[model samples]
Target: MPHNSIPVIETKRLVLRGPEAGDYPDFRATFSSYRSRFMGGPLTPYETWMLYAAEIGHWQIRGYGMWMIHDRTTDKPLGMAGGWKPAQWPEAEIAWIIWPETAGHGYALEATHAARGYLYGRLGWEGAVSYLDPKNLDSIRLAERLGAKKDTGAQTVDGNDICYRHPSPAQLKNTQISDGIELEIAHYADPKFRPEGYALD
Candidate 1:
């Protein structure tokens, strides 16, 4: 199986797919700008390059990683959302990032919902968490909107970040997400690319 054989998720207005070479420049610009402040950014060009490789490499090493979000019709790159966990992290996380220019359209929320559904329905995760900077109020609100609550008891990946635990699968089933988005996750029951649940190796 390809390292990034990750599923493609479609929302009402967005489409999330595996990362590609074309995605680097947009990611590079966003990551190097003030927009990526909360994500430990304003990084050097070399660091940006390495991080891009690492994100793609994540799928190779961990079997699950962030997917690039795009406009459904224009196919324009928006941002990224999905599960993430590094060796030093205490737990797996469902992370999201949307460019500041595209901030107001609720793209992050829609992509995140699709990502959460994949984590539960396809990957069989018991639950998920999102680690955020305490100052990132937008993400905090988005987390809450997605039915995630602050988990003061949970350990953070970095000393500065805070944890927000997402609702359980049963709880998620009870809450209504965006209307009319058919999140038909691809490759169901296909083991060629088994997503080893969000366990840190």
Candidate 2:
């Protein structure tokens, strides 16, 4: 797919689509708070704007980057989730950051599962890793739940970080629906890209 035609991924309760200019407020909020501490945040608005722009630019340059996660039912942006591989990174990585209000609702797990599926199944990636800060226990636990094992020998651009290797495509569990939750992947060429099973309208 062309860089502008980046795919949209949907999960039971969330829709993962390309970042928009409007999402900057929420994105900035997350980065400016203590919640962003692990992700190298607590930055000034200008810095946050630069980071946000880089996220949008990543798709143009790298062909893949983070998606703006939105609540499927309410169309409210939650945060971002998708593949991240900067020039200084060791390998392609699946990363996620849920907004404070949505932090404990399992949105990250659901959205990430869909993101990884797109990365491995659709993108033909052999595998990907998540570079996590040592003190980010929440992320570490989430990685464990996603079947990512600690790759102690892996090296990261930041010496203090550790790598969590995700399971291969064959090993990923099918996205199971529970409590009426569903997942969908959007195609760039389709104007009617929204999938059924969720009230995105």
Residue-pair clashes per prediction, in order, are 0, 1
Q: Each candidate: what lDDT? A: 0.81, 0.80
How much does candidate 1 score in TM-score? Answer: 0.85
lDDT tens readout by residue for model 1, 1-201 = 285467889876778999999988899999999988999998999999999999998888888899999999999998999999889888889999987667655677778888989989998999989999999888898888777899999988877999999888887774464222222112211345433542110
Q: Please give the lDDT score for candidate 2.
A: 0.80
Q: What's the TM-score of each model vs. the native?
A: 0.85, 0.84
Cα deviation in Å at residue 184, candidate 1?
20
- Per-residue CA lDDT of model 2 for 1-201, tens digit only, reads 354588888666678999988889999998999989999989999999999999999888888899999999999998888999888898999999988887655677778877887888888999899999989888887787677889989888689889999877766645332211222222211337533442211
Root-mean-square deviation of Cα positions for candidate 1 versus the true structure, in angstroms: 9.6
Candidate 2, superposed: residue stretches over 4 Å from native: 1-4, 173-201
Residue pairs with colliding backbones in model 1 are none
